[model samples]
Target chain A: MDKVIKGKVWKFGDDIDTDLITPGKWLGSPELKDHVLETEDPDFPKQVQKGDVIVAGKNFGCGSSRETAPEALLQMGIVATFCESYARIYYRNSIGLGLPPLIVPGVSKEIEKGDEIEFSFETFKLKNLRTGKELQAERIPDFLLEILEGGGQEKILKKKLKQKLKELRAKKE
Target chain B: MVRPMTIAEKILARAAGKEEVKPGEYLIAKIDLLMAHIAAARIVARFMGFPAKVRKVFDPEKVVVLEDHFVPAPTVFAANAQKMIREWAFKQNLKYFYDIKAGICHQILPEKGHVRPGMLIVGTDSHTTTYGAYNAAGTGIGDTDGTVAAALGELWFKVPETIRFVLDGKLPKYVMSKDIILKIAGDYKADVACYKSIEFVGKAAEDMSIASRATLSNFSMELGAKFAFTPPDNKIIDFLKGRTEKPVTSDDLVKPDEKAEIEKIYELDVSDLEPQVACPHTVDNVKPVSELKDVEIQQAFIGSCTNGRLEDLKIAAEILKGHKVHKKTRLLIIPASQEIYKAAIKEGIIETLIDSEAIICNPNCGPCFGAHMGMLAPKENCISASNRNFKGRMGSEDAGIYLASPAVVAASAITGVITDPRTL
Candidate 1:
């Protein structure tokens, strides 16, 4: 997780579903973003640069249990996604995959396309470098934060596996 | 006296090992049951890789794997994915792995009593909320989160706010649970409860059969509800009594507090409502079936976790008893579970459906989400009982799917157009 992230914003509208991010039909493709946001913005995958922040309206990533939705965005160098709210499964997917998707309620009203916004998901605050407006974002639970900081579930699992094994042995004793 | 707990609060608190939980509280709750579909089990297994988190499952009794989506493998790719799940389940010594034989996970879980009242359940498939029909707090999770639950017996959750939907009156004769939910979905919008849970209450909800209640909870996904549940009733209690080893009692039931922390309440009276349909591309684009009577359909499908229960099949059978499908349209029926298949067979629902020139396949998702069987060609139209009518969902992106209930689909299959079941 980046302590501070600064990037150009890519704005999306309400209910940006997993199909738009990583359609199930195209799940295994290497060029994931090839069809990413193709439903809404056909030009997104081609023009999206590294270190970009995607700010979306309500219920971002609504359908399916596709972790590839966030993995594709992260692999394409999306540093963060700020939305009014998120689908429950997608929110967990983002955290487990180490994508910084913060819920800053009304950031959508304050930020615009191509605006320069600086924020840290851990800090739970954002500064609009362009408009000089500051926004407060929702803070996540510590356990989830730990997973994000460790870079994903795999890294966290690597450590927990050893600990869990010890606990199992201790239980037997 | 202890504060009466909402079903969701009660289940979450019990799972989290807490006395009480607030609406927005976050906690790590233990999963009593975690279901994995082949769609996600294979993905999670692949991502974990190598020797993985454990050689065998952390707890075999608490996990289930169902191969419903592309069963019998619509394509070689799907078969290989199923192979991976089969191999992993066998190696992990998982207790319940219903390969293509079992049918959809949602229908099977309840059929097998895997879901019970006041439990914290999770599934890889989004419609896992289907268990909520039994008064459990179950929601969908992705493969990554599901993998964690599989490795450990627990997962974290931000307790979702609750919205109570009170149904005040009985549904009209032609209208079904599908119509009621479609009306709600359209009125509330797909994002109504984006990250929240919705509870169905009142006399109508209590009066509904376990199967009918499932239709309401299953379509909660169409509204993006984290979960949808009804307070346990006699049907649920009776269903669980025979299934569980323990002597069950009312103490196992959960109910909402008089002052439960509900975000909002939406009261609906359905005595006068008509059968509804959600048109293509969006679940919220709903309209009355009568208004869309001119819309012609080339296909009609009845079966999915949403409306493929024995009762649903019986309704369709009643409509198709002496009639044949229209020449221009094809009708397909895929039972939601093998148990449903047997029950429908015993009741002669299959004979009626088959004698009516309907194509009944094994219990599988069956083109519900474009995975396999009975695909639609370009510009073709379908009226289906499945949940979603999303664009390009069934087959070709150019095809259109209109969602209705089983009876409605059966009637429309005979008409080759959208026809309200009331007309029958």
Candidate 2:
């Protein structure tokens, strides 16, 4: 059983760089507990809900492949991200941190702020709870689905390595 | 009605056993190159913790290690991070190595001929897209993905469909890759291509040198593209001439298949374009320098892998030749590497810059990141050739940063606000 929590959407245009996500100046400080709240614009992180899904336009993480960008999102308790597109480094960082980055086509045009939506990520669809209009996303590939199920790339490697070790021991026996 | 496959699609389809890969389609391909930064220390520690059995050199010749970022550490933390990377390189026996005294990884990688056209490149740093100038499909990866690529020279990629950018005409006199990319950034406002690869074609791309084209493809990541590229031609062949020991002939050249499909097409004519600036708070918040002219700057940094090449230095020196940098503005010029520095000195580009009162630093990614020497005070503003202008990204959250081309940075060092290099 999973929980879906929706809030008033805050739409940010594409190419939201890692610098804005987690400023390097903050890296000087050792504190990792909700540093997102202290961003130049304080309202952004606070407006987000614990389980809220961020819907972005494109190139969502661009410039400076620092891990702090996704770390800030996770620290804010953001459960998933639905973007029309994402930067290569940013997408991998989010997935590595066990955050779902759903690639939806043309979803940025359909949704507006204050739209009450029901997102069934398991089914890969977003429904307007008030209007009952469902938006479908193109199917995510099986390998990515497997990584998502196995808890990201790092975890998948761990599981594979473990299985390989077991097989090697059995062969020796 | 016929839909022609884009150049990117044609290349990817040739490699892809499967028919088509749309935007969301995740098709895996064998990685061609693996690049890592100093953070490789942590990745090495992970491998040591859980050693992979029967591991020799995973793509030994293809892997490149560079200590570019976090150089000249001001604090003990950065020093330790550098130490970790040094120890790992020794244990891994990496062949292509660039230490802290060297320069930015992206600049070093291609200058040394590690980047090749049609090759898929992955780096630990995000700006790895800079290598796309060599016509390689390059992108950034995190520590985990990097470590995996180090252990197994392969990582899965969903061959990205291409967005064909057909350049309509030539650029204006002062307009360079920075303006073209910034104009494109404004056209799309950050989300246009998102996860797609952008392929630059037509006369505009052909006319630009590999370094200028590198700036365009490099910052394409700034527009949310997975990566961007321009196929190598005689220019790339010329660049790779002496740099590569193994002569790569055109016979082995990989070209796009004729029967491929393109996802979308974008066209732009940058003729008569002006110098652009990404104002503070966001790279996407772009505007021409004329729009926000006379905004005082405390610093003017003219280097980074982004704009630290010899051409960039020449452009800056040309502007700063006889003129002195503004009294309040500290003009810092760092070459991409010792090689570029030596070339600039040999060509008298260094004397021209020094005569203009510009502070010439060593070849490294120093103050562009604001880690050690160039940290800003609150309310300070900087005009920089480095990428990204997010709030507090350079030094202080209150510090305002304007991203510009090397020409603009040098010109601004003269006038002290965002000034167009052409006007000067």
Considering only chain A, what is the TM-score of each predicted structure? 0.89, 0.78
Candidate 2, residues B1-424: lDDT per residue as tens digits?
Answer: 3334554554454445545454455556667778887657657666765645623337667788878766766678878877877776776677876767667888788778887666778888777777667767788888778777776666767656677787768787767788878877766676666667887888889899988988888788776677787765778878877776576566544555455556788888877777889887777788987898579999999888778889999999888988999988899898988889999999999999999999988877777765666878999999988877776677877899888888889889998777887787
- Model 1 chain B: worst 10 consecutive residues (lDDT sum): B46-55
Which residue segments of model 1 deviate by more than 4 Å? A29-33, A109-115, A127-134, A141-143, A165-173, B1-4, B43-53
Give the per-residue lDDT of model 1 (tens digit) for B90-182. 877777877778888998887777877788888888898888888887888877777777777788888888898999789877678898899
Q: How good is model 2 by TM-score?
A: 0.88
Model 2 chain B is weakest, by summed lDDT over 10 consecutive residues, at: B1-10
Error of 2 at B184 (Å): 1.9
Candidate maximizing TM-score: 1
Error of 1 at B297 (Å): 1.7
Task: Write out fnat for all predictions, comma-separated.
Answer: 0.44, 0.61
Q: Would you give me the overall lDDT of model 2?
A: 0.74
